[model samples]
Target: MRTVDQKLRDRRRRHILTAAISCFIRDGFHRASMQEICKEAGMSPGNLYRYFDSKEAIIEAIAEDERKENATYYAKLFRAKNFLKSLGKMLGASLKKASDPNYERIALEVAAEASRNPKVAAMFAQNEAETKASLVLALRDAAARGEIDGQLDFEAVATILIAVADGAIGRMSLDPALRTTALMPTMKIMITRFLRPPDGP
Candidate 1:
């Protein structure tokens, strides 16, 4: 159970994170300032610094939170026995959010910064590795359930699926036009192909 002070601190931290993400999206990481972040968060500069020592710290926290959320999202599918059902639910959840124009715009900005910022890049890489490990474990479960054959290379296949999903989301975030046709279909095909049982091999 959290005390009132702890809850308030958590709320403030959340506000700071949301403000930092908005500022980073609007101004890019290099240009976003602590002063601007404070204004966006509706807190004084002194107060903001109490929550986060610097803009980089805030960005790191955001990345860590995003990574944790990603892991948690996939953990649900890993727990499920119904392969196609879990796949569809996951795809639908992702597509619904990514399809939103505002979310897509912010995600694109984050991706651009991720390419140049060493910390952000490393964080994303670590996040990807964790996600892939979770996926491989899930695939192994699917294989054991007879939904997928055991002979298939689970790690390799999980890597390919992760790559495909990342590629689709990255492309969609950059070009909204692609979402209309290729994005969802590519995702569907990947899930279908990956889950399909081997033809007596």
Candidate 2:
């Protein structure tokens, strides 16, 4: 059990992260200053600094939080009766959230920053690698249970799936008119087709 002091500490850190995310989304990461984050968080510079020393630190914290979320999502996928369906629905929900202007801005900004910053790149890469590994491992287990195609190359397929999802997110962010309802059923069909065993090879 967390003590009161510990809970307060966690809450303050979360507050700082939330403020940093808003500032980063409003102004690009490079332009979002520590002062702005402090003001947005309603904390003094010295107080905010006690939680996060830099924007990079805050971003890293966010990445860590995302990884934990991904883990929970995967655990839920494994618990589902249909792994492929659960995966599709989960990713569909994610894409739908990405369509929101705030989510889109933050996702695009983080992806853009990852491209230019080695540390940020590693943060995302690690997350992706863990997700991909979980996907492949889960698919392999599903195959053993005769739930999916046992003969398929799961590693290759996982890569393609992740790439497609990332591309969809990018497109969703760039095209405000895009509809998640329009995309999800097709995504479900694609996942089923890709993972299900055909009569022949």
Candidate 3:
């Protein structure tokens, strides 16, 4: 099922992506060039080009990888016994992940760059739409089970939830002292109260 050639290709691809991320974090996505990525990866331009010819390609790859990772989390949510609590924990984890400076800087810069690049803008928009769809599905399912309030529009709730998480990320990005541990308890309380069933909980 495995071949040395395929393994080597995967390793090279990972190496290139890692180097690209470092270049983006250090010099920024807008300023980081292919040559810088090649230098960072310790590979010739030709060699690196074979794996990924453009920074946009690397960003697309990163988006795809994150999409797969988020899919796993959404899948796990379906099996969670305490839906609202699990949802709170997932949001807390997301906030912590998104608050990392290295991640935030690169992600924000990429978002900025995407505004000027149609290809990247389309790719990013699709990724955001897919994530929102997954969230709406999960929220609707929770409501159907009578865990969350079924009266509220799942689409609007998902949008607000994502916006809240994004706001936390932006605020924490500016103020590193706003620790996740401190914010999470209040967030958890807010989530539980917002989604909890009236007669059941």
Rank candidates, TM-score, best first.
3, 2, 1
Highest lDDT: give the candidate number: 2
The C-alpha lDDT values of all candidates are: 0.76, 0.87, 0.86
TM-score comparison, 1 vs 3, better candidate: 3
Candidate 2: Cα lDDT at 77: 79
- Candidate 1: give the clashing pairs: none
Across 120-164, the per-residue lDDT of candidate 1 in tens digits comes to 778778887888888888878887777776788888987887665
Candidate 2 per-residue lDDT over residues 1-201, each given as its tens digit = 569889999999998999999999889987899999999999999999999898899999999998998899889878889777788888887777667788768877898999999999999999999999998988898888788889999999889988877788788767878888899999898988888887523
Better of 2 and 3 by lDDT: 2
Candidate 1 residue-pair clash tally: 0
